[model samples]
Target: MSDISPTGLGLRHSLSLTAGTPVLTLTGIRPAEGIRPGDRLVARSGAVAVLAAETSTLPQAEMVAIGASTLAHGQPDETLLVPADQPLLLRGARAELLYGQSAVVLPARRLLDGQLTRLLRREDVELVTLTFAAPAAIYAGELHPVTRPEPLALTV
Candidate 1:
């Protein structure tokens, strides 16, 4: 359809991201009268709030796209595409579907000492992960600290 176009630039890669999988996504504050996709909203709650017509300061690390089949109850009447790096959270019906097709590349590194060094030193590493089943819970959303750092800080 005319509504779907590939002109907008952000992160567009070919990969299969299933619905309901935890991927970073946004959630817009609902209005008193209620709202739908494409309906502009003034965020009044969440990690941060933004006045209508203003930019937001909320970090986009915790947002994730959910599967379509998962949103059977309280389905939003409308669905709209959310911008990848914007603060305006879009909540309507099936907006998470737009994000479900995303392709995420996990970070990996090689060490000179490799497995032998890690075994000898007995060093440990951890990877954090989360999953939400309810559509409402997914819409409610959560925020987490990014694994990557800007300036590189050491922790002891």
Candidate 2:
């Protein structure tokens, strides 16, 4: 959390994005989303999310594969899993779910599941923001990005 600065990564050099779904929702929660009248999945502020892949097209489109049941591994439709304490990538960004739960808006549409998406970038990787809001309604926390350690060097 310390390493993540207030300033997010730069996207000026990016070219395009692929194999991901960007999502955002202000309201509305369908039963398929997996939020029953008693489900309590809301948290405080969100954590710093990791973004190593690149993306483009949608302005502030985040490539996160959002879903409800982590048990079910597949596409994100109707159900969206709000990442707790995960980095919130801006549009055209992606989230790897680092730690801590920040304020989320909770996209009613499919979560997009960007974490699982591996986009083709103009560069090595790109970062995006993923907003989550409980069906109740929460404010944006203005969180930071997930910083990965330097590439590992293997030698003989």
Q: Write the per-residue lDDT of candidate 2 for residues 94-114, one digit (tens) a residue.
A: 223422333222322233434
TM-score of each: 0.17, 0.18
**Weakest ten-residue segment in model 1 by summed lDDT:** 129-138
lDDT of 2 at 74: 28
Candidate 2 ranges with C-alpha deviation above 4 Å: 1-60, 71-78, 81-156
Evaluated at residue 52, the lDDT of candidate 2 is: 25
lDDT of 1: 0.23
Best by lDDT: 2
| Candidate 1 Cα errors over 4 Å, as ranges | 1-70, 85-156
Q: What range of 10 consecutive residues in model 2 has the weakest lDDT sum?
A: 134-143
lDDT of 1 by residue, 18-89 (tens): 122122234444321232223332212222211111122333222222222223352222221122221223
